[model samples]
Target: MKSQPSLDTSPKVSDEIRKTTCYMCACRCGINVHMKEGQVAYIEGNRDHPVNQGVLCAKGSAGIMQVNAPSRLRAPLKRVGPRGSGQFKEISWDEALDMAVGLLRPVREENPEKLAFFTGRDQSQSFTSFWAQNFGTPNYAAHGGFCSVNMAAAGIYTMGGAFWEFGQPDWDHTKLFMLFGVAEDHDSNPIKMGIGKIKARGAKVIGVNPIRSGYNAVADDWIGITPGTDGLFILALVHELLKAGKIDLDYLAQYTNAPVLVDAETGLLLRDGDGKQLVVDRVTGALTAFDQKGVRPDLRGTHSDGALTHRSVFQHMIERYLDPEYAPEAVSEKTGISAGKIRAIAAELARVAFEEAFELDQPWTDFRGERHEKMVGRPVSFHSMRGISAHSNGFQTCRALHILQILLGTVEVPGGFRFKPPYPKPSEIHPKPHCKVTPGAPLDGPHLGFVHGPEDLALKDDGSPARIDKAFTWENPMSAHGLMHMVISNAHAGDPYKIDTLFMYMANMSWNSSMNTSGVIDMLTDTDDSGNYVIPNIIYSDAYSSEMVAYADLVLPDTTYLERHDCISLLDRPICEADAAADAIRWPVIEPDRDVRGFQSVLCDLGARLNLPGFVNEDGSQKYDDYADYIVNHIRKPGIGPLAGFRGNGNKAGRGDVNPDQLDRYIQNGGFFVEHIPAGANYYKPWNMDYQNWAVGMGLYDSPQPYLFQLYVEPMRKFQRAAEGHGDRQPPNHLRARIKLTLDPLPIWYPPFEDSHV
Candidate 1:
């Protein structure tokens, strides 16, 4: 390899061609760093990376500021004064590690269950999760506890697993792409690329949100719906879909659980062998049963009792939900948006979807053969994040958006709603050498004993969420939120079972969270006679006393992206897409200025210190000593595990021939994916029966609609039936999920835990 000359030295010049993954947001864009000597002088997107394709978002463009921030902690710091004093003394890695161990080891030994590990939204995967597990702590919370868990929960309830990639809209074939509350100012490469292609092809784009976003400006139509009322507007869209009989009923029947009404006891499909069940498909739309067998088979035996059955995913929604009083003529009353505008928007969406279907030479999956499937008669796509999902009814809002996407028949298709990375198989980046979980493995954390196990969230002998881990298996898909009560109880409780220590990594709960901020801080600060709160030993990995760090007993500095060898998968393009023909390379862009290490490195070291078996190699030291070696073991070594023959290393884009030793070459080449195209006439049907699964231990009452953000569907349904049986009028939908405990059954938005008053 030849050394690339520095472009310029005028404060922004670089001679080093460093390739690394962007950590700006979940969109892990492949970033190319041009360094002059050792300083990063310029940054740009890797043109060859297929996912981004020479595009970078505003956040990605500002990567330099993140790495070179003046506030970045350079060395490990020991709190010289009281906790939260923000006064510290620089110390060696040995001292910092020892201080951390001394503080936490005791807490763990006393009550390992009380030691809570909170990880922020960074490079999380099996490797990231291993630390919490090896430590034997029962309470492991993450940013998702506040960020996107609800949406993830919705996906799990509907689909087997949730994916974060939020696949590109089929702009090439889409007639209309809906932008709901996604501000492209903070963007990902795939989204940017997809939008560009859509605009270039002259497809219509609709932006439905309170504020006009950058992406909204480029949309063919922009509708400013009031904040928190996204659910109403989306429901109106579904109402329109049903009113016009334009839904893809056939696709729903074949693919999703939409058409099957599940049994309250078994969580099995409500249907018999031929798909006729207590539930009925009301859409009377497209009826193409393309993959019905595969779709319904997965839904079997996921209820209170273990048995298989059929239920339409769609009909189930209608059975449980009541159409809001806001008609097209009166949507403004409920959503504070004009009814005329709503009708126009609805009409435009339908017209576009229908139009694109013919343009792409595809028929509407529905029987009417309307072009409602796609944007212009193709497929539709929508996304909801912080701004939309951070509301009191955030989870419900997300559920509404998901339902809207399905009604439009835009899910799991090109220009439709598709989940990639962290959900799909053959992940883009190979698992780290010591990585325990398989790539894209879906785990019911609270419901199941561990990841990759069968689900067991069904009722126990007492009719609550089963206490035994056996009830939670990989086979059953349940909500992670159902176990939230447990986390809250643990936080508030001390004796019998309690978390005594807390480890936070790059996480600022008070700064970003929406659940009662002060309460969480109190929990974080819980102490006993010795003045130690529940999290007496707060170990943080951050550069500054940013709220959470201000409370840390020990603060350890960490290597930023430029200074460390990190993996790029969850936020990058879909693994299947990465395995396409070209994949991006993984190499350190800049040498570490200090001894600060990445999270994995610190954990690997800590695991060894604990004398963990898998931490070391045959030579006795840490086997996967460094990240690069770990990458080699997973991506290059053949027959190691699921990642055997993994050929993604180095920098390249698009799918290419798999390389054995040239991991970098395989990475440089775009990754792999099943070359997907328009699968002719696939249909998904909705559940038609009135059914509910029991939610054991959950004081769930019947309501108009009740859905948890994470797993545990059968339990929820069971609660619904129980409520009806009690003649409780199912408690008002608003109050049904309201609980006065630390963990509310439903989401209630509040201010963050810690606030930066200054």
Candidate 2:
């Protein structure tokens, strides 16, 4: 029967296959697009890709539909009817570009701060932010504020790096894996593949989430904890672990701030005249800097300077966590998990981390000149996402999760969570939020970054928020990612200040991207007594006609992801692996049939038209022809550019001069570049000398930035001191009490504000 029914099974599926990186979502997987007669016929994953390794999600596979969808914007459009009326007139690119410049040029020339430029789900933030900086707008940020900034900010503040895109659990050797509140929509393909690997190895999986679907469904154990109480639950685990002496004491003293001395009366770390944190060396029975070679820090050491007594950070931790308030029994009702269950989980974590500890015979040196004969491993790992971060108490809760990992000595280890390249960079090295905008000039520095103290807050002389979204203000002092969700509403209400133009990219603020959809629509359409739009003008860019397009006065249409040139840069959100530093590019596999341009390329043209300093050469000529030209020729630093591979004569890995054939080299190598970490530098990356040198050589750092895990975050205390009236830049009366209560230097759990209303 089979022989009789045999058909032309060997018929070709396509005429050719073109490889590129998929942009359907942030995963940035590599895909092989099969073309038949110069049109896309099918799509599959590239087996050699580091991110997914031949695994493609439903979104990635459905990218063909995205490119060929009939709903795509055919050309730029100008609003012909009232806002939110869904009426428009198609126009040429020249008309659209002129209109945009007409609205933006005045704002840049007079007061650049009047232009609020924000982006949503944007992959090219490094380039886009540069454009905004040159335009001199402090009111600029990506969608992370509304997406996952809490997780990112908390991780960067506490451990120098965060999970998800920045790092991942070591799937090959982990014995116990615990996942908490991870949305199934994020990093989908790689995580699924990781879980499959661990499951095949017969490892134990513990899922701690409110829902029992997706990854949790396949777990060996599930703890259905209450929502918004994750911090309390984590604190209880910390209490139990501390009480039972089940933590990695040596790891804490060697690699964290556990041994640093803190002034008991002032609640601040004790530092020398040069601002180096002081610690007690038990071996020498003397106070010294923490980084001194051969110093054995005493976790229980203390000193009295007559005026004030100082105690070790570990002693404070013991006092804080050993309290009855954080005990398993005390938090059982709030967390909705039984005391026995909490204790059991903590015990299991301890058992896997200590009793089952293993080691590799790889030798390495530490920043303090200490040498290790073998790389010790603690095979316990954990991960979490938005469920624990998108709440009022999210930042502290995320901090608690990091503290838990540090306690178990699992982070940056052989069988635990590991950072990708260009990470493990402490907050001290990151830029401070800059709001010193000058008319007709670029911003003083980057718009979005880490804020160290009240002095770093973005505020005017009168203490008003300097940004449209109120970022880096007394209201939210540590907002590493500016608040994009507040831009439209703030501009409409003129809360801090009014904006002449609300220029956005890709984000649909009138729809799911916003908190109040109906209210946002009204704000966009709302008028004052003079019958003038409150927000003045709006410019938007998107590939498809999303719901937000109706409210825009000018809509710059964009091409599909398959029809653009993009860089997944190491300078931006790279596609690096734990063991290898990597980056990728996406070039047009097929040309767009519509009269649209890539949003980034359009920005290049607009920047040049506006004569933005960064976009124009000394003679007033356009510096880049398009996005592709920028990717190849734009030098961010002396030797560093967007892509880190095939640089400088097409042979350099990290730092080199611009190579003209860089794109061609990437295409030949399957649209990505990777350089594996040396064996001795692969694990324990934060304090390991080998890894530090490797990172510097790769241009990840200018010098070896070996740092300790910040178990005791002192920057929080700086804000607390300001609340206590100890600083010149003090918080307002309404915010003072709240800041004092919430900004504890150590991790503390409190109920979400919604609990009070309930």
**How big is the positional error of residue 352 in model 2, measured in Å on the Cα after superposition?**
0.1
The runs of at least 3 residues in candidate 2 whose Cα sits more than 4 Å from the true structure, single-residue gaps closed, are 1-5, 510-513
Q: How does each model score on TM-score?
A: 0.71, 0.99
- Model 1 alpha-carbon miss at residue 67, Å: 3.9
Compose the digit string of candidate 2's lDDT tens values, residues 1-758: 45676699789999999999998888999999999999999899999899989899888999999887988999999999999898999999999999999999999999999999999887899999999999999999998898778899999999999888889999999989999888674688899999999999899999988989988899999989999999999999999999999999999999999999999877888988888888999998899998999999899989888987799999999999999999999999999999999999999999999999999999999999999999989999888888899888999999999999999999999889999988888999988999998899999999999998888999999999999999999898888989888888889889999999999998887643365888888899999999999989999999998888989999999998889999999998999999999999999999999999999999999999999988999999998999999999998887899999999989899899999999999999999999999999999998999999999888999999887788888999999998898968888899889998888989998889877877
Candidate 1, lDDT over the whole model: 0.50
TM-score of 1: 0.71
Candidate 1, residues 86-145, lDDT tens digits: the string is 788889999887777776666545545445566666554445555555565544545554
Instruction: List the global CA lDDT of all models.
Output: 0.50, 0.91
Candidate maximizing TM-score = 2
